[model samples]
Target: MTTTAPLPDAAPANWVDRYAPAWSRPWLRLGRFDRPTGIWLLMLPGWQGIALAGAMAGRAPDWKLLVEFFVGAALMRAAGCAYNDIVDRDFDAKVARTAGRPIPAGQIKVWQAWAFVALCCLISLGVLLTMGPLAIGLGAGSLALVAAYPFMKRITWWPQAWLGLTFNWGALLGFAAATGVIEAPALLLYAGGIFWTLGYDTIYAIQDLEDDALAGVKSSARRLGAGAPRAVAMFYAVAVALALAAAWTADLSLFFTPGLALYATLLWLQARRVKIDQPRLALVLFKSNTWAGLILFVGLAAGAGRV
Candidate 1:
């Protein structure tokens, strides 16, 4: 039996290590199920869209929709991780932080990773089918973005921008699912999510700056270099602005302003606290976006109350 150790980037004492059968550990890790942050980040945009639409409808968020999105997000994020690992296996092998990933470390074969992607996608499709036609179409349209994302670093200095677009597709899907049509507020929320991903993922990229430089990978962190913190602040500011605009476009009440303010303050603190040299702190700030996003969701929901 192959005894798989946790990868360097995995959360310590993650559930996979404690509960997963030994044979399943490699597969679980390959999907990044152990790192729940990515899953949460990916899932939040969808929830935000749902909440925003619900707010516009003057009702509490639809818990059923939330549950559906939770499952869909987890499965899709896992599939995305597997596909990215498959595509970046060579790059992963050269980067210190990513070298221990299942594929690069030889814990899982390339073929198995593909099979896992198929399995996850099939399950996600089941969930997608449960939604309306518009949501399904939006979800299907996202495949092209996902397919192109892994290669963005090889061709552009702004892979994070591509990621911003790809990661926030849920904002569109969630709104369409709830409202049966895409609208301006959803577009605004999607744009806000793109900036949010750009900011946090840049912080995440900071952890890999040295390794990425050596590997010939381009990232906003490397491009911004010493000014990365300021750039993150700028990106986060745009995200907050766009999100506030989205709420206003939805005609959310004044109650949403406080949440937006808190969200902005948190992003400001992250910018002030960021030190590119501190990989641990970078990871902390990157993960902190999860809470920050949740705050924004709460604000959007509160503001959506009956005007």
Candidate 2:
């Protein structure tokens, strides 16, 4: 049977709800497959890292590596979401938006959720095994970040910051996969992607402010309060600066700047529109970052070749 309705946070008429089989819909939602933006946000930094590495060496991006990273990102993101849901099931019940998630709604049991997470991770590890040792080590190292992320909202006002680190780990991993060693350009790119995640996720948190307040969940959004829009602008500015720094460090073609400019403009638009009261707009702005990230990827790839 079709699921009763889409989760509140999911997009209108999302494909997961519309197209996925009845038995699979709950599992998919448990993994947040209904909201593919998270997958893009998780995946893009890795792509950028691969592209940046390729650009630095004056070579085209490895299509095989790109495909591998995408698959890994999808699986790992699913695993992370399931794990988070299992841990936060109670808190999720108290939050209106999340109360309907598979775990919280009793669509899936805790042990089952754990199994889903493990299945995703196992497949993701299989993908990781195909890469070089440095990338493999980097991939393994990311689990620590992922393991710690679910509890961040309970302990810190800046869970988004932790997520920034977690979501962008792929940058380092991807760079390692391509070059067999970490480099200054990839580090800079990773740092820049952190700030970019910060900005976009801060916007994402706008959807949960009131629910979070009642549940005592701390977040950068709750911490920033009225300062959120300004803070997002500042974070986005830092992101753009760091990205440019990475390109310069890599000695990529000047063509990188144009894409970077467009990337900056998209972030600016998001920062411009965010108002604490406009949760709907916030969701739209948050999802737009996927496109922004892709634009940066294309730009970075196109900018390949030493000037």
Candidate 3:
């Protein structure tokens, strides 16, 4: 088992010091802002949902709404991370890779963390207020999922399921933002996003598998054991299938079909890479989903008559 030491308490280093503005580093750290991958992952599904909704409605997506969704996702994801860190501070301290996070490393106190969370949430709410009433209500309802997520690991062997529910919420919000209502196709896309999160998050959990076991944390990676790769493949298959069903229901054009095929190919590659258990490989495969998602969004946008 690999054990990560707590990062030293010192001045910000490298690009964090030179490029990141001095005023933002602490708050950024609070939100794991240095890790933009999480933000990208959170935003893509929302974009997909918006694109699909636009396609279904036979119009170009509202660019302002898309921008609003992006801003909201970034703010809320950061806020969610802050809240998660505060809730999991003790557990984070025990996990090597996470032991050096802002909270567990003592760079930020718990109360301060909560305050930061509130600040981020306020910023997010500001963005939410600009959306339609239905979007606002659906967005508010997501709070329950976010609030319950950090505690799921303590009681459930499938906390990844909870994460799937929480992380893919943007799918629902995006559709609502575009159409001002939720419908069957939007719900199907949201379900696909859930399975997508399950597959990717399971790969992510592998990085902490041994640590989680020793620390009494539960994850799908730990539960799946040697069959982890196979399980991921199965979940990805379901995700792709559901996504295709969503595209079909939305009456998307031929352009979207090729993108769906590409996405399925990418999932196969991810599954293949997961079988190797190389951390570096896993990280790369996870990051690749960002590109895969972008491609799918492009296809959807193209089919929706937006360039």
- What are the TM-scores, per candidate, against the unseen true structure? 0.98, 0.98, 0.92
Per-residue C-alpha lDDT of model 1 across residues 105-172, encoded as one tens digit per residue: 89899998999999999999999999899999999999999999999999998999999999999989
Residue pairs with clashing backbones, model 1 = none
Q: Residues 1-307, candidate 2, lDDT per residue (tens digit)?
A: 3466888879878998788888999998988889999999999999999999898888888899999999999999999999998889989999999998988888899999999999999999999999999999999999999999999999999999999999999889989999999999999999999999999999999999999999999999999999999999999999999999998888889888889999999999999999988998999999999999999999899888555
How many clashes show up in model 2?
0
Best by lDDT: 2
Q: Which residues of candidate 2, in runs, are more than 4 Å off?
A: none
Consecutive 10-residue window with the lowest summed lDDT within model 1: 1-10
For candidate 3, the clash count comes to 0
1-307: candidate 3 lDDT, tens digit per residue: 1222323322234344456666566667677666667878888888888888888877777788789877888888889999999989989999977888878877678998889889889998999988899989988999999999989888987888888888788888998988888888788888988898889888888878778989899988888999989999999999899888888787777767778888889888899778435655666677788877777777677666532
Task: Candidate 2: give the clashing pairs.
Answer: none
Cα lDDT of all candidates, in order? 0.91, 0.93, 0.81
Task: Output the TM-score of candidate 1.
Answer: 0.98
